[model samples]
Structures are given as C-alpha cells and as structure tokens.
Target: MKKVLVVILVAFIILQFFPIDKTNPAPTPGMDFLTIKKTPPETAEMIRTSCYDCHSNETAYPWYSNFAPASWFLKNHINEGRKHLNFSTFATYEPKRQLHKLEECIEMVGKKEMPLESYFVGHQDAKLTDEQRKLLIDYFKREKAETERKMSF
Candidate 1:
C-alpha cells in the first residue's frame, strides 16, 4: 500500500510536466465580433472580463492553468465554449447561426447560466452585480433583435 501510494504521487507529479495548452488561438481577420461590430467600450470590457476566458480567443490563462489537471479542465472548457459560440469567429458563421447565437446569449445571461459558476471560483471579478446583469441582459436582447431585423432583410 505504501509503495502504491508513493508511485501514484510520483505519477501525478510527472503528469505536471505534460501541461495542457493554454495558448489562445490566432484571431482571424474579418470574422471576429469586434471586427464586425462597433461594441461599446464598457460592454466590451465586461464581456472580456466575464466571458472571454472560455468563449473567445482572448483567454487570459492564470498560473493554475500551468498545472496538469487544472490545465486539462480549462482546455476542455475553452473548447466546449468555442463550439457553442466563438466570438472570434462570429462573422464566419452562417447569418442564421449568428442570430441564433445572439439569442442564446440573451437567454444565457438572462438566466445566469453563462460565465459558469466553476469559472467564478478563479474569477471573482467576473461576478455580475444585479445592475450589471440587467445591463448585459438588455444589451443582449437588443442585439438579438437587431440581428434578427438585419437577417429579415
């Protein structure tokens, strides 16, 4: 049992040397949300602080992301989030997809389902106050409506 325990500890230590990649994917020109839309600075900052880590190509990886298991988790989350909505590739999506993503964004923020709770453990600043939530929720609704209107034409 003692030998087994030591071996497991050593294996875990060794795994740390094989840390997961935390590098942000290179941004593509003409496709990114910022490039396609004129975002308000305050809203952009809020989105950057709250959602970009997992959702965009601008993830600000922290020190813990250098560790093996944690890095693995972070990488998985980033991948999954991008699949759902990659702001970095927003305009590259079909127009209907773009509108659907905007609608989903509104639903997620309105229900407090985004910026997942696990994310908040390491990112207290991502916490949205009631006022902030309202602001974002309203913004998301308006964006969704505008996108829908544009798509209709």
Candidate 2:
C-alpha cells in the first residue's frame, strides 16, 4: 500500500510538468457577436458569465486550470466549444451559419444543456437561473429572427 501510494504521488507530480496552454486568442471586438448584434447589457452579461469561457476567445482560466489532468480536459473542452461556436469571430461566419448558430443557442439554452454540469462544479456563479435561461433563450430567438430578416434582404 505504501509503495502504491508513493508511485501515485510521483505520477501525479510528473503530470504537473505537462501544463495545458492557457493562451487565449486576441480579442476582436468589432467581430464579436455581442458587439455586432447589440445584445442587451443584462443578457450579454449572462452570456459572458456562462458561455464566454468556453465559447469565446476571452477565456478566463480558473485556478484549477493550473493543474495537469484537469487542465488538459479543460483545454480540450474549450477547444471543442470554440470549434462549435466562436462568438469572438461571429461576424466572420456566413450569414446562414450565424443564423444556424443562433438557433443552436436557443435550443441549447432552452434545453438547459449549456453551462455544462461539470462547469458548475468549478463556477457556481456561471449557473443560470430559470429566469436567466428564459432571458437567454429569448435573446437568441430575437437574434435569430434578426439574422433571418437580414439574410432575406
């Protein structure tokens, strides 16, 4: 048991050497969804608190992100989230893609699948209340409608 414990401790220490890259991409405010869409302040704040960490270039890494295995998982998760939807570069996406992404936002928030449960473990403040979810859903719906309207012209 003692040997096993020693080995585990050593392995854990070794893992710390492989830190995840914490460099976030540079901000592009002109192209950001919040800026381009002119999202309401309240709704934008909610989105920033809950969604921006993973979904935007402005990731604010938490303390745990300094650790290894957890950091690796977090980096992978953030990369995947950005791949799916990068709000920092929202205006760069084609109009149809933007509309589709807004639709996705409505679906994800309405279904309460966003701000993943694991995220809440580290970020309690990021948790959305029922009212906040409704607000986000409504905001996304409105954005989608606006996008569609612009696409028609």
Highest lDDT: give the candidate number. 2
Query: For candidate 2, what is the total of clashing residue pairs?
Result: 0
Itemize residue pairs with steric clashes in candidate 1.
none
Clash-forming residue pairs, model 2: none
Could you give candidate 2's per-residue lDDT for residues 25-141 as a string of tens digits?
Answer: 989999999999998898899999999999999999999999889999999999999999999999999999998899999989888899899999989999999999998898888
**Model 2 score (lDDT):** 0.94
Identify the runs in model 1 with alpha carbons over 4 angstroms from their true place. Answer: 1-4
Per-model TM-score, in order, reads 0.91, 0.98
- Tens digits of per-residue lDDT, candidate 1, 1-153, equal 999999999988998989787667897857778567667888888888898888888888888888878789888989999899988889888878887898888888878898798889889999988788889888877777888888889
Off by over 4 Å in 2: none
Point out the worst 10-residue segment of candidate 2 by lDDT: 138-147
Every model: Cα RMSD to truth: 1.6, 0.7
